[model samples]
Target: MQKKAGPFFYVFLALFVFFVMFPFLWVLLSSIKPLGELFGDKAFDWFTSHPTLKSYVSVFVNYPFLRYLWNSTVVATVTTVYTVFVAAFAAYAIARLEFKGKTVILGLVLAVSMFPQIATISPIYMFVKKFGLTNSYLGLIIPYTTFALPLSIWLLVTFFRKIPFDLEEAAKMDGATPMQTYFKIIFPLAVPGVFTTSILVFIAAWNEFLFALTINTAEKYKTVPVGIAMFQGQYTIPWGEISAATVIVTIPLVIMVLLFQRRIVSGLTSGSVKE
Candidate 1:
């Protein structure tokens, strides 16, 4: 039998929800506010006197927001796909096959993930510059993949270790090649881990600001976060426009997370559980 919830639990939960949601609500409110009220003394007003879509309109008219969205989408998608693809094989190798220095390799992958991005910025910039990849899709994609791969590999390796050994043996007895067994048996069973890793990688690449800012000097190649930061006026900052742009870019992420939230929860929990 389960105990009934008390009023205190509901009260605490409400407070926690409000605490977490206030910033998003504030930003949402700011996006629709009239520019005058947004910047004026009424800036902190909980509710707006006048709400309009003018700021949203201004964003598209004044900036190439769509191009920024496109650049982010392409870079993030490519990064997630490439990182997951490479990490899948690497993880499989680490989890299933016997090899030398396997523990050392796993430790190294984790170390790379823990290494600060700030520390690598200068060297990465120099390397990318030497290859003339600055202000290009490949420039960001490569670094994004590098940062995302380690974590993805670690997650997949841990998840793969949870899978049954008999699955592999069964496929082998059916005259399946090693590659066939992996693709047909192991790979299909690992979709949850793959999806979870892809979500994390995609979000990290999509919201990555420092790398995007450093690698792309041209406005045309700027991602959404960088582009939103660069939106300004000679005299005063356009808060409404910035908020509107932020809301625009943030909506897709929110929707994506909402739709796949169940899968994400299940994937993460499944990976964490031990047999």
Candidate 2:
């Protein structure tokens, strides 16, 4: 049996958690503080004497924040769903099937994933504009899916390889067709990987700022990231409102993680066996 954690472990753990959570804690504290207290002499204080939900109210009351939220949700969800659907099949093939130049293909996928978004943005923007797809959800969705796929494919490839081929052989012996085996046996067992992939892809797409700002020009098409940027006044930034919006947008992610924490942990930690 492993020994229990020592005092040093608890001290390090507390420090790690504090540093990791400090930014979010600050944002949370700032969101509830009254503007006068937040910007006034008491700004340095940690606790707020006058805590209120006014900034959160301003988030919805003063702006079309919900529409921006819907835009982000639609784009992120579409990108995640499409990327996972395509990546699952692709990864399965790479992991299980015999094929030529498989190494080269995987290398190319990794190369594509490594290419900076800045390098591709110009071409992508021009192509979208040429096709009159600018300032639309589709424009963002397509690019986001493209960028997310390479990593998703790589992740699923590792996961698919971890699954025992004996399972596949058993399914085949049971008169299960190849497609049925894949759909029924492999996919279900790959749930941990899929759940993990969806979370990463959704978070990437949801929090992406440069692409959202570059591809979507219309105010109505703007996502939460870009919409939050609009909180800047001509000369002054609305810190409280920005903090509130940050909190609002973060709730969904927090909820998703809470809901799928088990799968995420399993996905990251699985695959210890050897043939």
TM values, all candidates: 0.92, 0.91
Q: Name the top TM-score candidate.
A: 1
Q: In model 1, where do residues sit more than 4 Å from their true spots?
A: 1-3, 232-235, 265-275
lDDT of 1 by residue, 1-275 (tens): 89899999999999999999888889899998888887659988988878899999999988999889999999999999998999999999999999899999999998898888898899899989999999999999888866899978888898788789999988889999989989999999988878887887788899999999999979899999999988876887888888899899878878988999986665566545775
lDDT of each: 0.88, 0.86
Candidate 2 residue runs with Cα over 4 Å from true position? 265-275
> What TM-score does model 1 achieve against the real structure?
0.92
lDDT of candidate 2 vs native?
0.86
Error of 1 at 140 (Å): 0.7
Estimate candidate 1's RMSD in Å: 2.1
lDDT tens digits, residues 61-125, model 2? 89889899999999988999999899988889899888998888888888898888998899889
Ten residues in sequence with the least summed lDDT for candidate 1:
263-272
What residue pairs are clashing in model 2?
A: none
In Å, residue 55's CA in model 2 sits off its true spot by 0.6
